[model samples]
Target chain A: MVMIPPYVPEAFLTMYLPAIYAGLIVGFIGTMAIAMKREEIHILILTDLVGLAMIFIVSAVGTDLAEALILPGLVVELAETLAISEILITREMRKIEQDPRRNLSKSSSLFPQPFSLDMEIMTTAPNFIALVLIGYGIFLTGFTGGAVAGGGIVLYALSKKARGLPVLILDGIAGVSGIAWCLWIIGFLLFFVAPQYWLLSLFLAACGLLLKVASKVGLIGLLMREDIDKE
Target chain B: MEIILIIAIALMVIGAFGIIFLKKPLDKVIMFSILDAGFVLVVVAFKYLDVAMFAALVDPLSTLVFILAIVKINEIRKNKVSGELND
Candidate 1:
């Protein structure tokens, strides 16, 4: 026979959880109230706050596993925002009767110059920053590593374009990317088919992921540059 | 509450209010980044370094997308309004 306590708090309950909950409530209510009166563009910005609220809720769980879960949710949030933004732009472009070229020329200076830096610093900063990020990313490995490395590559690509430097595309980059995909797949298969070779599989998967992610992100950067050049 | 937690909460609350109430879209974007920065701080407070790393790397890309959308929309609106005036 066991004597049960009259009241027992939940294991996961914490003081901070309440604060997070309050924040989420505030975020949601604020977004809803303001979104009702705003245009589509304004509403789109509000949606990101909703995503942040979701992150707060998830992180309130306060566990290593729960924290890991936030990464995927963040990625999904980014992807959704991107797709919606693109769709909105396309719809507006089709609905409006205007010459896009003229507008593009007028708005080419999308980012304002906030500084009067020398050209020497501008040319070297991107390279240094990208190298540091990529190196740190490689050391980290896994999803975080991929993200860091991908960001570095994107910055590098964009900086190249900003300086009017030609971004060289290697002929075999695509082929290497394809092969890396196979490596990742094979590594996954081995995890299930041959659990004993876990170490080997892990190495193969990490290497493949690094190369695959870098190549794909690099290609995206290149596409963005081309689009900007077209404009 | 811990100092870090207090700072995080402050950043987030202020950011939320600013994003909702700010008159300019650029200000809203700026507040969004501030909110994101607070979220990263929370992650750091929780000792989830890996998650924090990913979030820090990703936040700017999302902001860039927002900026791009804002710029494009504004340009489109300007052209449409001017065309209407001409007509």
Candidate 2:
């Protein structure tokens, strides 16, 4: 009936969904921090583009369909990334306005604006190394990224209505997948069948919470303001 | 019957708490990374080596990009400093 995991075992993305999710969260948080904090969004943007490039290359390079869909996602991403950047900038501006020490040059704060490469290397490099993989480079690999492939311009567009909602949604989708996958593996370590559906639900829950945060943060309002400010 | 499973599961639970309750930004990053690693450890443990490896690689990439972004935003923030701050 439900066709739950252990009942069927290995339900498509359930296996690698976790990696997709982990990458998405990293990409989402990474980009959001850069967009709002950095003066020059291009540098980190390019680095992320490079990261996406790797995803694109790995997913689409030899596969014809992947190549076909490449431009679609990238084109949408260009506009979407910029839109998200603008919203982030606006929110940062709003936060800055609130600070009583607005005049104090509070250069360093939690996750200070403009990302930290030095710390990234010490802290995040190992995580990124994990993203480069493609499931034994054989059986598990697919034609497109899980998040990207989940839907297309249509779903992305639907999520866009959330106003900065799409990116958050996409990131959640990917991050949760990573978590579920980790659980699946642990299940294996204990000699058990993966609870594929349960894992999916966990990822979906995280995505839902993150979207709620974005909405509450006034991120969408920031987007609206940017569109009207026309500065 | 097993300790490894307990440790792995516990890490995930704790990582979740850290991300939610932590106030410090650096701590948030640390917690997030741990959450990420814990996630990877889980996937790989289940013989989902493919998923595990990718999970391991992505969190860092995400972290690197994140740090770079924060730095860039700070630089821009500094540039935008108003006259009042300068005085």
lDDT of 1 by residue, A1-231 (tens): 533343433564554558587767968785776658657778777777877778777766655766788988887886788788889977766644365655544423333322221234326666776787788878876666777787788767754644443334455777888898899999999999999999999988988888877776776776565554233
Instruction: Compute DockQ for each candidate against the true complex.
Output: 0.15, 0.13
- List ranges where model 1 is wrong by over 4 Å: A1-16, A30-38, A93-121, A162-174, A223-231, B1-87
DockQ of 2: 0.13
Clashes of each: 0, 41
Return the top candidate by DockQ. Answer: 1
Model 2 regions more than 4 Å off: A1-231, B78-83
TM-score of candidate 2 to 2 decimals: 0.36
**Model 2 agreement with the true structure over B1-87: per-residue lDDT tens digits:** 256567777888888999899886667778889788777777766878866755665565456445544555555666557533765
Q: Highest TM-score, which number?
A: 1
Candidates' C-alpha lDDT: 0.73, 0.49
- State every prediction's TM-score relative to the real structure: 0.62, 0.36
